[model samples]
Target: MAKETEIEEKNLLTRNEFDMLADTYQIKPPQFFWQANTYFDTPALEIKEQGAALRVRTKSNNYELTLKQPASAGLLETNQTLTEVEAKRLMEQAELPEGEVKESLHPFIGDTSMLQKLGTLETYRAQTSHETGILFLDHSVYLDTEDFELEIEGSSEEEVRKWLTSILTDHDIPARPTPNKIKRFFTRKQELAR
Candidate 1:
């Protein structure tokens, strides 16, 4: 009975299924796309400044920074979900000076660019509980202008690393690649147990 209850309580949603539901109901995308995965981990970080002129370095290490503008009035708490217009309103309510707005286009999902790049684009792919097919993202971008991370949906993390390596290496940028946190869970847990 306990095992059955656990299974029932642990129902998972897949990426495509979730996306379809979002489209059908006109629900805004969840703030943390990575939540769809069993575990979320980012192995590499890229640091770039606004204006595309310079990359920020922390003692020779490049770290990515993201800045987000909320559309609603007042500060949007972490884990808060907001529509695009609401996010914009939040930004204005914060009384921050106006900044540049950019556009991003997704190759697979119609020729539309709902993707926004404020600074550095941190890209990735991962499996979701909703569908068998993987979310194929050409790239997921993170903006340094905002204080948030861009959780890109990809078919897998390996695919994401390949894409990131290609783009950064092409641009003469070096990155520090790390493994997913899930893979290290056992190790970390065992260490703690000791």
Candidate 2:
């Protein structure tokens, strides 16, 4: 398990604002690529209640299983690299791999077999480096809902937050409450279920 802290700040963006920010960052349109993320939880939503999220993400045919948990500093992320075969099995059969990520889930989910696919969200994303850290532009679609977001990821929360705020101020873009993608996805999933 490769464990690390994830610190980022986010803001909701309009399509026009997204384009304007790309210009501000001097990024071209061709920089974006697709990323697919499949989320998992017990049928009873045990993982959600525990304030954790489990997901398999694909980038350039490489699969990574990651478990994100609440931490004192930010989110504690534990990642496990998976081979193509392992990723295929998990996606097709809901068979979670036996490794660090699964082991870490034991406290919240006793029987690993309880894990099930919650849903998938796909994003067309691009990023550019910044002195503060990195700036990510995302247009994600899932459960028939689409949204745009700007994320500032850095080694420290305070830095990311300050940079994000400055970007908003400089661009005259109003800040919108931005929750993490998982929460947004799960909230929409629940809405569709009703």
Candidate 3:
């Protein structure tokens, strides 16, 4: 298990802008990979109400469970590596894996058994380092919907914001409001259910 404070700046990007930036940076080939993220929440969304999200991400034949909660800087992320069987059980049966993730989540969600898989989002992502920060380009698909976005992660919020402003301006990419992947997944799921 690992605990870390994540600080990042993100923006919504148009497909054209995403392609333009990628080309300019020469971001191609094996830098990009696919990952599937499965989100979990209570039937009443109690966990979301408390400003927290739980997800299991599968990438490169590895699985990891993560809990994200609001923090002063950005978000507090707690992650735990899971075996294939553990990941399957959690995603298919809503069984909380035993470890730090579950222990930390129990306080926010009283009964772990009530947690169920809400939805899944698949994304193709590429990342590179830029000026003391990491830049991420993402294209995500969920519930027949798709979006392109960019994210910059840094040690400090201010640093990330500064770099993000410059990078977007240089690339001529308009800055737009963007939610995290989980929020977008939930929104799309709701839309599809209607």
Task: Give the count of colliding residue pairs in each prediction.
Answer: 31, 0, 0
lDDT of 3 by residue, 1-194 (tens): 99999999999999999998888778995789999999999999988889899999999999999999999989999999999999999999999988999999987988999999988899999998878989999998988889999999999989999999998999888889888888888777777778
Better of 1 and 3 by lDDT: 3
User: In model 2, which runs have C-alpha deviations exceeding 4 angstroms?
Assistant: none
Model 1, span 1-194: residue lDDT tens? 00000001011224454354344434454422321111111111121111111111111122211122222322111122334453443333321112221111111122212222222223332333333222222123232211111122334545544554453355343453322222233234335558
- State TM-scores per candidate: 0.21, 0.97, 0.97
lDDT of each: 0.26, 0.92, 0.92
